[model samples]
Target: MAKKKFIVSALAGILVLGGIGVAAPRHAAAEPVSGGEITYGTQTDPVNWNPHQNNQANAFLYLRNIFDTLLEKTENGDFVPSLAESYSVSDDGTVYTFRLRDGVTFHDGEKLDAAAVKLNLDKANETPYSIYAFPNYDSATVVDDRTVEVRLKKPDASFLDSIAYIGWGIISPKSLTEHLNDLPSGGQNLAGTGPFRISSYQKGAQVVLESFDDYNWAPETKAHQGKAYLDKVTYRFLAEPSSRVGALPAQVDVIEGISALDVSKFKDRDGFVYLSNDANGDTFKLSLNAFLSPLDDVRVRQALRDGFDLDALVKSLYRGEIRRAWSHTSPVSPFYDKSLEGAWGNNVENANKLLDEAGWTERDSEGFRVKDGKRLSVRVLYPTQLDREQRSTLLQGISQQLKQNIGLEFIVDLTPSSTYLKEVASGAVHIYPSTWLHSDVRKSLNGLSNGGALATDNKADPSIQPLKDLAAEALATSDNAQRIKIFHELQRKAVIDDVTYIPLLVQAYQIAASNKVNGLGFINQIGSPEGVYDVWVAK
Candidate 1:
C-alpha cells in the first residue's frame, strides 16, 4: 500500500457564527457544528478490514481511526504513547513493559486493560495471516491489571517501531472472545478504542465512522481532543483516479491520493490548494523470480539488471517529477544512501559479456540466445491500468533493449490486480512489478527478505545473502546507531551486489484540495486519506 501524504496549511483564527465562537461553516445553512458529514474516495477497495491481516495499508489507515495501538508515529517521526501512557524497555531490549492509560473504554463499553492488550497481541501471533507471526515475538504477559509485558526472542531495536505498525492495533477482549474466528478473517464486527467508532460498514462500497462521545484517552500528539470534530466520516470507494479527482472539486471536501498527472488540473481552482510531498514510497519494480529457469542463472540475472536505463525511463514515464532509485530503500527514507545512486544503469557491453560467459553463445533464428535447446525467454506480467500501462511501456523498452543487445526473448502479460497478486504469489508469473511502503529499512526488508513462507525466493541468489544478513542484524540489535550503520550497509549491498529487485523511482504523492479546506498536512510514510483529520472546511 502506498502512503498518502498529509497536506495542511496554517490558519490564523477560529471562525465565529451567530455570536458563538465556532469554526467557519464550509457549506451554506450549515453551522460550524461538530456533527456533519465528510465524504472521501479511494482508488481501490481493501480486500480485508481486519487489522491483523497483512492485506493492505489503506484498510489499516481507515482502521487506525477505529483501532488504537500502543504507540503511533507523529508527524515529526517520534513514537509517542497512544494507548499506553508510558513505556520502559530492558537494557538488553528483550522485554518491553507498558503502563496502560486509565479511564478508556472501547466502543462496546468494555474497560481497556492489560489483559485486553495481551489478548490482542496473542491473537496477532496466532493468526495465520498476521505479518507479525514470526518467531521474534516470544510471549505477552500481563504484569498487572493495567500493565503488560512483551518478551522478544532477540533484542530488536525496531520493536517499538514494529508495534507502531497498523497490524498491531489494540482490540477489546470482549469483542475477541465473542468473535475470535470472525475477527481474524475480516468480518463486519470491527471494534477498537480509538477516537472514532464504526457505525456501519458495507463490504466493497463505504464505511461510516461516528465519533465516540465517551472517548478521552486520545494521544497527546493528536491536535483534537475528546470527540472528533466531524460528526461522521464516510469513506466512499471510487477506483477510478479521474473520478476521485472529479468529486473533490464539487461535493467532496477532501480526496486522498492525487497522481502526478492530475496535479496540474487543480493548480488554480477556486478555494483550492495542492499539497504534495516526496513520498516515502517507491515506484513499482520488476521482481524477477530467480527460481524460475533461465533467470535462475546469475549471468542472465546480471544481464537483465545491466540492460535497462532507469533514469531515462523515469524521465519519460513519470515526467521527471520522480527521483530514480538505485536501492530498495527510497530516497526520502532514513536508510537512503546518496552514494549508491545509479549503481545499476545501462551497460550494454557488460550485459553482452555476461550473457556470452553464461554459455548463451548461439543466437536462434529470432535473434534470441538459446542454451540446452531452450530459448532465453520469460513473460513480464503487469496489472492492466493506466498507471500500469506506463510501467509496462518501460518494461517493453527494457525487453527490447535486452533482445537487441544480448539476444534475449521476452513477453508481456497484463492482468487485473486480483489475478496479479494470486499469480505472483503462486509463482505462475516469472517477472512482475510490485511495490513496498516501508519507512524503515527493517520493515522494508522484512516484507521482502525475511526467510519465511513470505520471503521471496530471489534471496536464494548468493549475492543477496549479505544484504539479507544486514537486515537481520539490524533487526536483532537494540543499539540505534549500530542498526543505522547496518541498514546503510544493507542499502549499499542491495544496490552494488544483490541486484535482486530493480529500484525504479520514488513517486511523489499529489493532493489537490479546495481552498476552503485548511489544516491539510502531508505525512510522507503512511498514505491514507484519514490524514485529513487535521483538515477542516474554511468558514
Candidate 2:
C-alpha cells in the first residue's frame, strides 16, 4: 500500500463541515509517562466484537480499540485521514475513493490493501442486521493496491460521517473469514490495525487488551501516534451503578455511567476526576407504534403527547443533570430546530379535546378511555438494559400522568435486551423505548423512517412515507444549509404533526477517572471514548 495525496472537493468540504457536534477531551496537567495498565469499569459487556456484526453502542467502547475506521472524525466534526491517508468524492456525490496509507498491518500479521477495504464494505452491505449497513451502497471495487472505490446507489452526504464511525471500522479479512460464525462470542476471534488488540475476552466478566506495538497510523487530528502509551487495558463489566462507583480509583482507573447525583464523589476528590459531556446523538424517546389500534389515529397520538409534562419529568428525574429534549436529535446538534422549543407540552384540556375528537369520550368502570367498547391502553415495550432507577421513575410518572390527564392506561412490558428487538419488531407493543447512537441527524431520521431499523412494521404504513422521503432528500443534498432546512421540515412533520416519536431526555456521558490516567479522548460526535491510544499513566 502506498500513500497518495489529493485535493478534497466542495462536496467533501460540506461533508466534513456537516459534522456539528463537538466533544470535550480530558487532558492531565502532568507530563505523560508510558508503561502502565489502566482498568475501566463499564455497565454492560458487548456480546459481539465483530465490527460489521455488532451494532450495540456499548460495543464501540471496546471495538474501537481493536479496529480502525478508514477516516477519523474530529471534535469539531471534520473527517481526517487515518487508515485512508486521503480521499476524494465524485462530483455527483455518489462515488468515494480512498487512498490507503502504507506500512499498516493487522494484528494477525495480514497486510492492509484496497481489497481489504472493498471486502469490509461488501460485508457491511450484505449484513442488513447492522445499523452501519449502507442501504444505498451499490458496490465496492479495488482500484489499485492502495486505492479503493465505493459506489452508492444514491448521493448521500452522510456517507463519509457514517464510514468514520466505529461500526464501519476495517477488520482483518482473514479473521472475518475464519471466525465469521463465532465473531459474536468475541474472545480471540478479533484482529485489527488499531492501537490495541484484544488479548482475551471473558464473557459476562471482562475484556483484556494489549497495545499493538506495530501500530503507527492515527488520524491527523490526534495528538499521539504510533503505539499506545499504556501497555494494557482491561474493561470490567459492572452492571450495577453502585458496584461501578464503589470500584472508583482504588479498583478501576476509569468508570462510566456515573450518575449526576453522585458527581460529588469524584469532583475534587483525591486521585479522582469527574468528566461530563453532552452526547451529540439522538435523545431517548418513545416510538409510538402507528400500526397498532387507537395509535393509528393522529388525534390519539397528539392527545398522548399533550398528556404528559416531559420537561418537568426529565427535570425531576435528572435533577438538571440531563436536558429535556423536544426533538429527535440533541439540542446541541447544528441541525436541531430551535423553534420546536415549547411547541408541545402538558395540556390536559387539549389532550381531552383531542381524545374526545377521536371518539374516546366514554370511560369504562376502571376510568380508562373506551372507544367502541375497547379500553384505551398502551403497552410499552421496555428493554431490561435501560431499566435503571431513573428510567423506572420516569415511566411511573408517565403512567400516572396519562392515566390522570388522558385516561390512557400505560402497561409496561419489560423485555430482555436479546428478545427486545424481536418483540418490538413484532409490533405487539404500542410503544417502544429506544435511542439511536448516530451523530448525524440524517442517520437518525433514516432509522425512524419507513424500512429503517426503528420503522419495523410501520414500513408499509403510508403515514411515515413523508418522513422517509424527507430523510432521503436530506441524505442526497450536498449543501449543509439545504440539509439543515430539510431536517427542520422533517422534525416538524415527525414530532409536531405526526407525533410518531415523543422526545424525553438528552443523555450525557458521566465518567469518573483516576487522575493518574491522562489524555482521555472521545469520539467527536457521540462523545464515546476513542480508545486509550493517547492515554498515558503519569509517573
Candidate 3:
C-alpha cells in the first residue's frame, strides 16, 4: 500500500489573505466568510464528471469534492471512515463489514444507506473497464440500513489503497438506477454525497460546484465539517500551460500541472504559494513491443535496454525536477527497492555483444543492422503535447546516440491525444511513452502482464509472469511487514530482469495558486487533488 504523509504544521502558520499578511487564525474557530467563487485551470478537458464513467485525475479531483467515498486517507497515511463511520476486516482478510454513518443524504436528497452502498458497489463491479474489476470482488451484502459487508475472492492487503483510487468513489443508488443502461458507456449526470454538489456543467468547458450545507460527516482530517468555505468552485479547461500559468497572476485562485521551469518565478511572491511534492502518483515509462519481428528476441530487447541513457534525458528535458526511476515503482512507492539500480548509462560494447549473439551481424549500405532482409528499426509514438514533445526529443537523441554506437535505426511517430490510445490498442505502433496512474505496483504491473491489448501499442505481448506472481504473493500475505518485503523483491526482479517496460522518470505534482487562496495541502498518494474539499479562499 502507498503511504500518504500530511504536513499539517507546514501550512498552519502560513497566512495569505488578499495580498497582505495576516495573523494565523485559530483552528476550527475562525469561520470563513463563505460565498466566493474560485476559478481553477487544467490542461486536459474532462471527458466526463460522473464517478462511474470517468477515471482521469482531473475529473476525480472535481468529483471527489461532490461524491463521498466509503473511506478516505489521512495525512499520516492511515485509512479512516468517511461515509461509513467504521469498518472491520475478517481474520482471513476476505470479508469487510462497514458501519455507515447516520443522517447522511446524497446531493440528490436521497437517503444513503447500506442498500445504496451495495447498489453502488454492484454497479462498479459490473462496469467492464472499472478499477474495481482488478480486485476480483465476489459480492456486497446489505446487512441492514446502515451496515454492509463486502467479500473478495482473495485476501488483498492493498484493498484499502485500491479503494482510495479515483474510480472507487461511491455514487447514489438513485443515480445508478436512472443511468443503468449508460453505466457501461459514460454518464453525464453527477450525483455524490460529498461536501459539494454540481450546480452546472458545460461539456468540454467548465464545471461549477456549490457547497452542500447539510454535509456533516467530515473525517477528522478535515478542518471544516458543516459546509465548504467557498460558495462555489469553477473548474475551467485551459489545455495550454502558458495560458494556465498566465491566468494565475490574473487572479485565478488555483491551477494544476505547472511546469518546473515556472516554479522559481513564483516561489517568493507574497500572498502566493504552490503545493508541490514527489507523490507516488504516476510513473512515466517506455513500452517495448516484444511481439515485433526483431524485438521478439530476448537478446534484442536486452540490447535496447542497455543502449540508452536516462540521466541525460532527465537533466536535459525535465531540468532535474523529476526523479529518475529504476523500476516501475516511484521513490515514494512502498514497493520501491533502492538496491536494484536497473539498466542505466550507455553500454555500447555490451549492446553490440548481445545483438551479435542474436545473429544480427549483417548490415545494410545505410549502416543499419539487418536480419533476414528486415532492417533493425522501431517507430516510437507519443502524444503531441509540450511535455510529450520534450520526451520525444530526448528519445530521438538517445536513438541517434545508439545508432552511432550500436547500428540501430529508430523513428519517431507523434500522434494526437484523441487517437493515441486507440492506435496503441490496435497495435499500430511499436515504441511509445505511457504512464501507470495507480500508486500500487500490483495494479500497474498487472495491466502489462494480463495479455490484454495495451491502451497503446497492442502489437506485442510482454510476458509479465514474474510481476504477476509477485503481485499475487504481496496481496495474499496478511502481515504488513511481509507484504512490504515481497513487494520489494518484486520490484527488484522487475528492474534486474529487464522487463517489458523501462521506468524513466517520476514527475512531481505541481499546482499554481494565487495570493488569495488558502487551505490547500499536500496528499502524498495517488489522486492527491481530491482533497480540494479542505481548500478555501479569503473573502
Give all candidates' CA lDDT scores. Answer: 0.63, 0.78, 0.65
Model 2 segments beyond 4 Å from truth? 1-18, 451-455
The lDDT ranking, best first, is 2, 3, 1
Per-residue lDDT tens digits of candidate 3, residues 356-426? 99988999998988888888887777776424324666678778877877788878777776677677777
* Candidate 1 wrongly placed segments (more than 4 Å): 1-33, 183-188, 281-283, 361-367, 381-407, 415-429, 447-468, 478-481, 522-529
Give the backbone clash total of model 3: 5
Q: Candidate 1 residues 409-428, lDDT tens each?
A: 87878777667767777765
Pick the winner on TM-score between candidates 2 and 3: 2
List the RMSD of every prediction in angstroms. 8.4, 2.7, 7.2
**Deviation of model 1 at 468, angstroms:** 4.6
Which is better, 2 or 3, measured by lDDT? 2
lDDT of 3: 0.65
Candidate 1 has a TM-score of 0.84
* Highest TM-score model number: 2
State which candidate, 1 or 2, has the greater lDDT: 2
